[model samples]
Target: MCSDFEPLGKSSLFTILDACKASTRKSLQGINYFAAEAGEAFDGIRKMIEDKVALHNDSARLIENLKRARFYLKSDYKVHVARSSNIADHCCVYALSDPEKRDFAQDCDHEHNESCAECSNLTRTLNEIERLLEETEEDEELLHRTLKKFRSYREAIEAWKAHLLRSINQDLCRENLLDKLSNDEIYLNLDWAMKFLPIKSREPQSEFFGKRGI
Candidate 1:
């Protein structure tokens, strides 16, 4: 995600890139060991759910539970992104503490579990659907539907990450260009504007007023 800072010069670009690197590093590696563990703990639950769905494709109740779990898991990821700056705030303490024991996925092994943490805090689920065989999924259409949704979700996440990185790269390119500029040379950044209209002396009022159309 682009931060509030804008790069106006090489020095500014350096600072912006440094901050972006730090933010990405922290987000991926986590602020502390516990935070990273929370993410891994969530992945374990997701994998466990996938295993259950594979083993018991005929269980409709289990499928429904998986559906509900999907909703909770996706919502948890969104909340985590929104609250990335403050993980402990606006999140369930239980989910934050010893997240390995939060087996919401296993809870769905039999039936839909209605109870969740007060804030419904869970970890961000990653893409690990490679183990699923197409033939097995074909046997259960509902299972395929659930997995498709997860696949789409993961694709969207990857796309966003790509876009953020692309934007950072563009800024870095601009910085490089500026760095090569000679002392006498100047850089002009042109931004999009409304259509240009040629001004004429004593133009008609109607023509002058309607000359520009965006």
Candidate 2:
């Protein structure tokens, strides 16, 4: 959950980060239109929206690549297993044709078909791919859980930002007490800093900060 977990490399890990950033930025930009003043704040929000759109598009491409990788791995697994089964079946047929020759044929066929170095290597490859797939799946689950927590954090941030902006706008228009306006910006900045800083930390601490912000 390290903000350093910022999307990197060609892996699905990057995809998750891109998606999270995209969602967070888009939400912030949407909220900003209703929450912030014109000029700097509005321009900043517009830039965020543009950046988030790009990230979102990149995430989509990454997801498609992941799907293709998964499909290839699955197809390879199926083909390897099918080939193994067919070879085993052929060995069984040869062994059954002659009772006297059964032992030799079984031993020879098992070594030739099932225990060949090439077959062993292919089996190892399949096992490794399966393990990688499982790890990728687990990573994806963790990413989703992290994203859910992030969404909640974002919602709270938006609400707090909007409330502060409204208070400031009201004060500027002479609708709120000046004394109240005096503390609003300070308290809002404090709240935002508290929420933003710790999210940049590593997991567990990051999650703790996110929940606390909520």
Q: Residue-wise lDDT of candidate 2 within 108-135, one digit each (tens)? A: 3334344433334433433443343344
Model 2, residue 69: distance off in Å is 39
Q: After superposition, which runs of candidate 1 have C-alpha atoms over 4 Å from their true positions?
A: 1-125, 128-139, 193-214
User: How many residue pairs clash in model 1?
Assistant: 0
TM-score of each: 0.31, 0.19
* Clash counts for the predictions, in order: 0, 0
lDDT of 1: 0.43
Note the Cα lDDT for every prediction shown.
0.43, 0.38
